[model samples]
Target: MKMEPIEINEITGYWTFLRNIDWRDPWLIGLIFFHIFTTTTALLTRNRINFQVILFLTLLSMAYFSEPINEYAALNWKIFSKQQYFDSNGLFISTVFSMPILLNCMLLIGAWLYNSTQMMAQLKSAQMKQRSRKEAGIATEAKKTQ
Candidate 1:
């Protein structure tokens, strides 16, 4: 028995549909909110809006969608193995399981990149200020000697 793969759109739609429902697993909802907030922070602080972040956002959203996927799989997916039936998590772990892990890792990497960019920008500004001060000092000395 083969488990049907959940479509990314379906996952998104699932979240949308459930958004109105107050009843939800707190653990899953908390995870979703945390990822969303952190990813958004990364996007705002990111130095360059390149294709890489775009791809990362795509995957991040995909990760957001997986909560529904897990729910659907638990309720709907039926795979037969001997006398016992294992769920979707039993097989194709990489495609399904790895998605959320990748999402979390990407969020962390994005945060790091954003913070590094901010630090470098600050360093550059400081160097400019120091150079201006040195130039002013030299000019003042030249006038004093004259």
Candidate 2:
């Protein structure tokens, strides 16, 4: 029997769509929440390299312990068996190393870029204020001498 993949559009919205979800698996739900939390945290944080590293590690760990990956393996056991590829643990281990590393790098780069822009804007504003103050002082001095 052939199986149809779940359409992304089907689950694209609010919590009301929970009624349509067939498998109420806790692991799957937890993993989804974990990913959301880590990704959101990574994005919202400002200038915290250590926090980014921690979040990246959390995301990577989530991939290894992901219920979705296990479910997929179970559903396609035949395909997995046909190949000489390692078992579910192998899948988890491989993901633990790769996906998290990439995610961490991206988060770090984004944070760096964002912090740089903010600093540059502040510096420009300060400079402008100082220039204006100096000009006002010069104008007042000229008027006093006139």
Cα-based TM-score, every candidate: 0.42, 0.46
RMSD vs true structure, all candidates: 10.7, 9.4
Looking at model 2, residue 53 earns an lDDT score of 68
Off by over 4 Å in 2: 1-33, 47-50, 53-97
Give a tens-digit lDDT track for model 2, residues 34-106.
5566667777775577877676566666555555655566567566333222234554324433455456557
**What's model 2's lDDT at 28?**
39
Report the poorest 10 consecutive residues by lDDT, candidate 2: 80-89
Pairs of colliding residues, candidate 2: none
Candidate 2: C-alpha lDDT? 0.58
Highest TM-score scorer: 2
User: What lDDT does the true structure give each of the candidates?
Assistant: 0.55, 0.58
lDDT value for model 1: 0.55
